[model samples]
Target: MAQVLPPLLDYEQSYPCPVCRQGQLDRLILMDAFSCNVCHHIFSVNLSQQSICLADRTPALGWRWARQRWRPLHHPDIDFPLGIWILCGGLTVLPPTILWVMHYIFPPLPDSSANSFPLLWIGVVGITHSLIALWILAEFYQLPLYLSWKFRLQS
Candidate 1:
């Protein structure tokens, strides 16, 4: 009868530091190694010879809570909606509002074009919509800064 060996575990699958397991790592200081906040231990293990190090061991509980609270607003993956909103609002709303004001200020010419009362109403609607969009955008802009500060404090 031949003796059988158990399967070898991959380094990536194994815990780099015995003190801190994978999920318990508050932050990954390097690709393979992490500092354990619970035990305040810094240890290294071989993970593809990257020479990774773990320096700090403070947990970021406040940062984590803040991130969760402002999750919806701090998405870097999405394009900044405010920039698009401002651009489109300016292009679509300003011209109509100007035209509407001009119509009210100046009397119709003798060889007159038709009255633009309909367009004037549309302009008012556009301006109202743009104002609402701007308010929402202002609220979103603060979120990124909040998250960045939180991360910085954590590290």
Candidate 2:
């Protein structure tokens, strides 16, 4: 889904670091740019486009600020967190796959009901695991409503 991001409208605001993803990009004192505290990367801002690019790197790569995170300005097709998606996909698909393989190798008891038991169990477990993985993905992606509510309650 396309996200509506807040403009890098002012330097007074702090943004999440695009490099480290853990630090805030705070405006450097006496400078027209921002620097990430954790990664120590300086970024030059383009107010017109509401994007910021690394000061020492090519300006072709830039990012914009979503409400609680940063979105890449360029390469929209490749902007997701690959590692997280891979991890979540593995978690969701691995266990059921192993279970199915094991079941195939060693068939369940010959009893009529018993034959169906393994299939039912595997289906239930797979659905449960998939739901959990989706939850993890949502949390990691920081869904706006959930994130805002969480912070509000914490405060």
Compute the lDDT for candidate 1.
Answer: 0.45
Q: Write the per-residue lDDT of candidate 2 for residues 74-154, one digit (tens) a residue.
A: 664366678888988998899999999999999977866678888888899899999998888877776767555655676
In candidate 1, what residue range of length 10 has the lowest lDDT sum? Answer: 61-70
User: What tens-digit string does per-residue lDDT give for candidate 1 at 25-111?
Assistant: 333445444445544555333334322334343441111112112112234245566676777677667767776676668756656
Please give the lDDT score at residue 63 for candidate 1: 14
- Superposition error at 30 for model 2 (Å): 21
Judge candidate 1 at residue 23 and give its lDDT: 21
TM-score of each candidate structure, all chains considered together: 0.25, 0.46
- Which residue pairs does candidate 1 place in steric collision? none
After superposition, the stretches of candidate 1 with alpha carbons farther than 4 Å from their true spots are: 1-114, 143-155
| TM-score of candidate 1 on Cα atoms, chains taken together | 0.25
